[model samples]
Target: MNYLELYILAAFFVTTYGNFLDVSVWEDNPEECGRTRFENTTLDVADYSKARVGQFPWVAMIGSIHPDNQILFFCGGSLISKSYVISEAQCGRLGQLVRLGSIKAEDTEEEKDCDECGECALPPQDIKVRKQIFGNDCSLNSVQRIIILELEKPAEYNDFVRPICIPTDAFCHTSRIRQRALTPGFGHIFSTLVGVTERKEKFDDMRYVNSAIVTQEECNAIYPDLLKDGEFCVDYPKGVNHSCVGDTGGPLVEYLKVKGVARAFLIGVAKINPLICEAEDTAPIVYSSVCNYSEWISNQIVSSIEAERKQGRRLFAV
Candidate 1:
């Protein structure tokens, strides 16, 4: 090929796929976590409906495999690292398989292709749970309902599967209060009454809702007994209901600019609410504060790696 022709071809390639190439530098660096490879340029963050593929790559579906080989997903969680997922204690007993990289709730195929742009995602990962570590104050009555699930192997990173950043000191102090955040999950989308039977329709696709942070005093007025020191609440927009059944243990994320790049941070985990789907409008959702448990999370991960090394097993090298 002539030099002039080669230069033209290279320019066309850069113009068409420059954004994808720009983020490749962070693909292997654990320190540069929480950035999505595929940017959702179409949808606005204020949209409170179905989420676009590759928008929130760290959202995980926690489920169990039955003896008949059927998977029953009952909860949601966030992938904090290649080897660990942060969830609630209630989900610790329920999670046998942690699914990542796909938005579909039930699909036979290993990989999902985006219909909008004709881009194909890597195969979805169904990693086994090697261990379940509960928080120090985890209990039925306590608001500290945190649990960290250790995956049997490190999840391979791709355009659709990556880790969300843990909250930094600055993020916790500045961005977590009186600010709107996002909660994503693959849960019940809606319900209907057929004759006498009220049937709740499970969502086939993942969805997200934008909600505002509720102050402790405001949340206490609603559930005084349930609101505790290490917990916070978020209220959905008017006429919008979210964080329903099967969403427990999912993440409440806050987006902020880090070094001129937009990034997401894990701020809260969805705490189980009995009236989640029942009260459509007025119910404020509670979440376990990830900021308060940051130290505990770090300590557990360090100890878990040590324990695994003693037995000749190496966890994901994050």
Candidate 2:
């Protein structure tokens, strides 16, 4: 009623919200270091200056929007299709900006040629939302177009790095045997983690992290339990990293089909990194399984693509 009464109510709301862990704990990660799958390693890897797919371009997302649209603060995303994009539903809630086709990714090179087109290269694919779906609650994206991309049969969630890729006859294959999948994201260099490692090399410090798809075994080692029922995983004996932060909603693809999505996997999701980073040994990164939900994934991408078609965007026909 009065100014003092209003102040009391405001204070109550502030206190309530302050104690809320509702905010994603992911910030404690890349904010202070790198995203989960993308461990802050001292290994001198690839250069981010190139635009590649199934690797970095597919795994990154856009950052908080900028009023001036010159250089966008991009996150990470996975290219699931020529039209669809996937990432954590939470990003939508956090006011995170997600423009599927617009993303260049963590290690992308600026060129007009890097669009999703023929397989084995980035598709000249575009991103346009048609029907967005949420599973649990209003805790999902603000965008109403979201549709559920779930397994044929619903399953428990895993806190792992699972990504999804849109599938098309021209864009995918059925074989599960995989290798050197790509993943990427933008975050602090390994230097951000001061006392986390014992690598005694300086050159290792100059590397930029890129995106690539990895095997489930490689990734599951960090958090074995993350490979839930509906979810699937992949590994790269050659160091295919898991989908990390700035990579939420990105695709965890295999050849072509959209498989998993990137997220912390806390609220009912599998903990992709069971151990996350326990041993310093040279082990591979574990990725959350996406293909396991082939049925659900199919429905999701199909629905999304069809919607896109209606909106004037050409989509791959199953």
Candidate 3:
């Protein structure tokens, strides 16, 4: 179906069924279906730098409870629907919340400093994560380790907040390989090639690095045990750019031309790699293939909604 039709259908399902929202309806739409674009916008994926304020509305900053009784930007995540945020199994805990609509402030190290960064302020909706499911089991570094978080309430769609499209299995397995994609996150920004010159301070905006998908053979050589079925690898261009500590669980999205329109698709989830920040050209960065676990994600969302309906209250799955 077309973009408009898909949106209407999705709304209808939520209204009529009140629990079961068809995940495939929007999945079939163009990748740019729910994004907010402005005229005269210029994006440079090659150089790789901080993103515009609202350039990626579907991106969310995950906040997990710390031992000090404060919330922190534990990891990155992507908003897949009004009620779910797709993240990595190890990145977020079950009781944490995800922040949307605003960019993370630059040069902010603590939560107090974030509150003063006016434009980077968070949205009012504090959607608590009601349930967290990592496919069949919480196996780290695997596609099955995708964490599907059910928000306590449905997020309101707007210019500053939106959702990205999840591709079908065919699209991920056949089409996305060997394609150029953007990996955005709040990771560390290294000045020189050595250690982090600007460490601990978060960027004022989302940082994006361009990467090209590589064949499984190339990645398999580096990660013999980690590279498995339903997982893919990307190669960072010859440069000093790559994902850092805070980038894991973030979206690895690719833009495609659908009927003369540029659309975005969530192809994979960024896996943790301490060595990748300094790794250069042809260095393979692994990601959990999103398309491979599409079935498990949809099933979890549907099942969570059904459970919430039956219980007549919110439920948190351990």
Root-mean-square deviation of every model: 10.9, 17.8, 6.7
Residues 1-318, model 2: lDDT tens digits: 345433443343344223311232221111111122332222334432223332233333434444564323322344332233344444333323333322343323345323244324332232233344454344422222122321111111111212232332222234434433333343211111231122222121111233344455654665566444434443323342322222333333222111222422111111123223233443333333443333344444444444656899643321
Model 3 regions lying over 4 Å from their true place: 1-33, 39-44, 67-69, 105-125, 139-143, 188-204, 243-246, 278-282, 314-318
Q: Write the per-residue lDDT of candidate 3 for residues 174-268, one digit (tens) a residue.
A: 66666777777777322112322333344655667777788888888888877767778877666634445236678887765444455567888
Q: Give the lDDT ranking, best first.
A: 1, 3, 2
If ranked by TM-score, best first, what sequence of candidates would result?
A: 1, 3, 2
What are the lDDT scores of the predictions, listed in order?
A: 0.69, 0.32, 0.63
Poorest lDDT segment (10 consecutive residues) of candidate 1:
190-199
List TM-score per model, in order: 0.81, 0.40, 0.75
TM-score of 3: 0.75
Q: In candidate 3, list every pair of residues with a backbone clash.
A: 32-263, 105-204, 106-203, 106-204
> In TM-score terms, which candidate is top?
1
lDDT of 1 by residue, 1-318 (tens): 345433443443334324222342222124436788754222334445766667788988887789997887777888987788998777776679999988777754745646345666667889999889986665665555788999988788777888887874555666556787777887622211111112155567787777778888898998878677888888776656444633778888777665567778788888756445655455777888888887677667666655766889744443
Say which candidate scores most in lDDT: 1
